[model samples]
Target: MRFDQQFLEDIRNRVSLSDVVGRRVTWDRRKSQPGKGDFWACCPFHSEKSPSFHVDERRNRYKCFGCGESGDHFKFLMETEGLSFPEAVEELASSAGISLPAPDPQAAFKAAKRNSLTDICEMAVRYFQQVLQSPAGRSAQEYVQRRGLSAETLSEFQFGFAPPGRDNLKTALLAKDVTEAELVEVGLLIKPEDGRPSYDRFRNRLMIPIHDERGRAVAFGGRTMDPDGQPKYLNSPETPIFHKGTMLFNVHRARKPAFDAGQAIVVEGYMDAIALSQVGIKGTVASLGTAFTEDQILRLWKFSDEPVICFDGDVAGISAAHRAVDRILPALTSGKSFQFAFLPDGQDPDDVINAGGVSAMYAEIERALPLSEVVWQRETSQARIDTPERKAALEKAVEDLVGTIKDERIQKRYRMDLRLKLSNLFYEESRRNRGPAQKGGGGGGWRNNKQGGDEDRASTARMEAPDTPAYGVERSFCTMCLMFPELFERHFERISQLTYSNELHSMFMTALVRIATDLAEGTVTQIYNKLDERFYKILQEAIVSSRPDEDSSKASTLQRWDTLTNRLQILKEDPPEDFVEHLFLNYADMLELRMLEMELEHETRAMEENLTEESWSRFQALKQDLTRRREDCLRDEQELAERGTKMKLNKAAMRG
Candidate 1:
């Protein structure tokens, strides 16, 4: 029995592929990232010493390098177990909590009719292509040429044209024995409400065929050739095979390249997709000119976990990105998310490419902003949090949006990220910017002021008031972000998510990120000047400036030197660039373990309050994660030390 594609999709989306695979194999903890839905285990079909079987739960598919065996959830069951295809489907459906549809004769009939309509669409596509090649499509050909689309591109994308007549396509299709109702049903011909004959739906436009995964022409997206066209671009009405929200243009063409590249590019227009494809950027697809949908986001995840959304840098494009962020937040999984690549003011991908070539377009991609940063920026861009109530409102606005995330792990991470940012923001707003104060005979740096008032106490509580055991690590990451923002751009998403234990350090981060994203260079001096006086002490602690008046005998002086020596080892002359990144990540790992410990404390309390199986499992998972991170931290530190020693020895050899 054939199943509905959507029904199968529903089952696939709801059922966890890793959970099924986990029952059969022990995941290699070192290689498997459960949070990312990516797992590695030895191939079950072929015996292997090392893990060669890989699973991408986001895509609900698995592949084994050992035996070249690959498939989705149902495929895995059919191959692993002795189950038939139908049996596997039923099992997965049952697990997904979906009721199987009763067998119906009409279902086959409807499916056949739907396919017939798709064939009719193919015929219409050929008809449009024929007219474009002939003398009648001169204007459309001119438009194509002017857009810099080559003949190869035109043929590859099946670029076509419709003449300026309502009945032109209808008459041609009807002559081939296509029924008027069938033509109207497939969205090729529009049926007039009045007592008039059906006419063509697309006219005087450059027609681009929209295909499905099977490479069948299911719909048409038309760009108007007329200069004063009202809508500018028109698409087919929702037909049996064409649903705008779930369909992306060039999916059949882009999927392989996107999967191969391990990334995908989402553009706002098909013309942009075609242009990029022409320029060798094959992993690009265009969204239907509709509001971004959750279904579309999920579908994109099949191709790439963090697909880049390249929208125009104009007002409308920015608006679309914001709307996509709103639609994407709820559907964000642990590993699956989106990034935004905004072009120069009023520029799209095509414009950038035309002016500076493909490299310019890539430069835009390199600077794409993470979804979290986008949300953080949108909330804080025009925000004024001078008063406590305003700060609460700011927190509420961001928290309400983040709370919409369905995944518990991702939601918690977002919550921590927000608290860190807001801590910086709130502390800056409420801090009394005092000048250099006499603390321990001015030998020590800024002393911790005794914060009072309910608001101040609440701020401290939300920010995790006390310094963590990994305070040194937190300061290192914060310092790196401020001092070397460019070197760590690749790790910006992870660094930005780190919850800085110190409020002033968090504030420095918030400012640094804000400036960096605004197309300005992020410098410690810029942040220092822009921030309140409280950040001065934090900055001094991070970069390690000379304080001649400091007494060496003092504990605070000793503490400052200790922090500088232990964490900021880069100061011991030049290290390998890669080593610096690894050191940065090492610091990140320690801080993550610190945050996990805090989570462990909370989960322990909740488990005590309610001794349920799920709570117990969650608590254990946290404990396991904390343990694993500690191991990773140690491993990283050893590697950094070895590499650092090697670098120092090499430098000494050069000097000799």
Candidate 2:
């Protein structure tokens, strides 16, 4: 369904854009605009040397000068993180405390079908929970007890038991008025080729309800209590709501703590996540009975830049770590890091936590190796570098890995370090292989090949480098002004219309137009009061960037005021018919009158304090000028109102 623009704007008004962006980025406040109150951060949208991203709180919009990218909160989320429009809208709406409109009837119908399925799954979980308390579930209960799972852990993970009989779940769901179609859709009940009624898909097994991040139970994984079972563990097939690859078991409980801790511990199984949490390592997530996917890595990256992969220290565990390293390396750069931790042989996180304690687990985590070490070991170990061909192959592998890095400085550093290590290993290996006849050469063909590979790897690394730009302090100040409009308006006349590129100039001009319109409508205060968090951040950033100081002398202020009045007259010469244009003109005239009144008040106060003839004369002149300008402004306003009314009448007559 298409979300209306007004609804989107309402959501934007409630949610802070800075808060949302700040969750994923570190915002640096520029020193020059600290008092003005603006935030500056490197642009997340693109690579840049300095922060050119401007967020105008007064206007409730953000624009990046480097990329010419501008948008409201929803657009920012959609573009910055590559989320779907609906997803972006939903995220903002949740942040803004706004309820989404009901889906279309057609969409609602489909949603209801899914809800029906979810209801059946809920019934199944309840049924299994009840079964676990029954005599028939004695074996399942025994299995849990043997695993040393506490009652609290079991309940939190929704651990349950499927009854021994095949038709137990079917009868239970049917009793709850769940339709046969929904039971099949939820993957709890299976339909046979004979077109008969549903039967339990899982029987005589210990049940674990798999929940998504929202805590909605979408599927189940069942482990056999009896050794005679064909498959040791059975899981729900891919259904309407459950995709094994994307779902992370226990993420609903782990996400917040992980975000707060600035790290996430990824385990290999549901029990591992449950066990880790039971032992006080609460920030733990597990794959849903499958291997990790790139999508899962990306999702985890949203929460924390550092993710620790805790796997078994067996051959399979090593293999899994290698695979994870391969999947995660391309996404790794300056801001993010990954690590791999291998448990003692044949031990998973659950076994270690249960055997030693939480400290043991922490020790393991502390000893985790960096991703670079893992990659280097994995690549170098597999290659036979005794021959020139093998050395060339190893060099090529290193190049491929280095090429995956997006940051030039990081790539260069890693390449040099790896080359030195490889060179040392090659020299040692060559020395061992040398014979009496090869004394002069010392190292064999491998040593020469390694030397050549190291040079080539270093040369290949230099091919891709980053471009740098010269950042200007004035441009940064202008960005600050764009972010803080209240301060801009306070010193509007004093600000010089500095020369800038078309893009930066247009962004600043739009902000000025918005501020003028808001002031004219007598809604400037209301605008900030009602602004969304995102826009408020933009405003704060602008204010902080502009560095508006209040120290204007009476004479200089009045001269600037005259210049602004003249400019406003020109701006209003051919005002458009739109409400915004009329508002700007009105605000410009009011600003001029306000300045004149301030001057008159200052001069009058000075004359009273000094009681000098010259001061009295200056006060009289200022007062007269203020009175005449006020009258002239009032007349101009009246004329504009009359003209507007006449135009409206003319349009109405033409329509009639």
Candidate 1 regions with alpha-carbon error over 4 angstroms: 1-104, 431-474, 477-656
Residues 467-578 of candidate 1 have per-residue lDDT tens digits of 6555556666766654444455657787667776766667767765664454223322233346555544444343232112112344232433324443454444445344
What tens-digit string does per-residue lDDT give for candidate 2 at 1-656?
67887898788777776666666556665522434335567666544546877766556677778667787777776544445578788878887888999989999888887777776788788888998988888988888898889999888888899878878888777777877777877788889989776688998889999886667888998988879996877889999888888877887788767766666899887878888898777888888766678778877765566688898988898898888876776666554667788788988886787777787888788667667667776776556777756765676677678778766656644554454344434543443477533221211222123323322222221211112121122233343344323334445564433333334333544554454544324222233334332232223232222211112242233222112222233322222323323434454445555657767878877776788888887888887888887787788667667765665666456334
Q: List the residue pairs that clash in candidate 1.
A: none
Query: On a 0 to 1 TM-score scale, where does candidate 1 land against the true structure?
Result: 0.62
Q: Which residue runs of candidate 2 sit more than 4 Å off their true CA positions?
A: 15-97, 194-198, 400-417, 434-656
Residue 630 error, candidate 2, Å:
61
Best by lDDT: 1
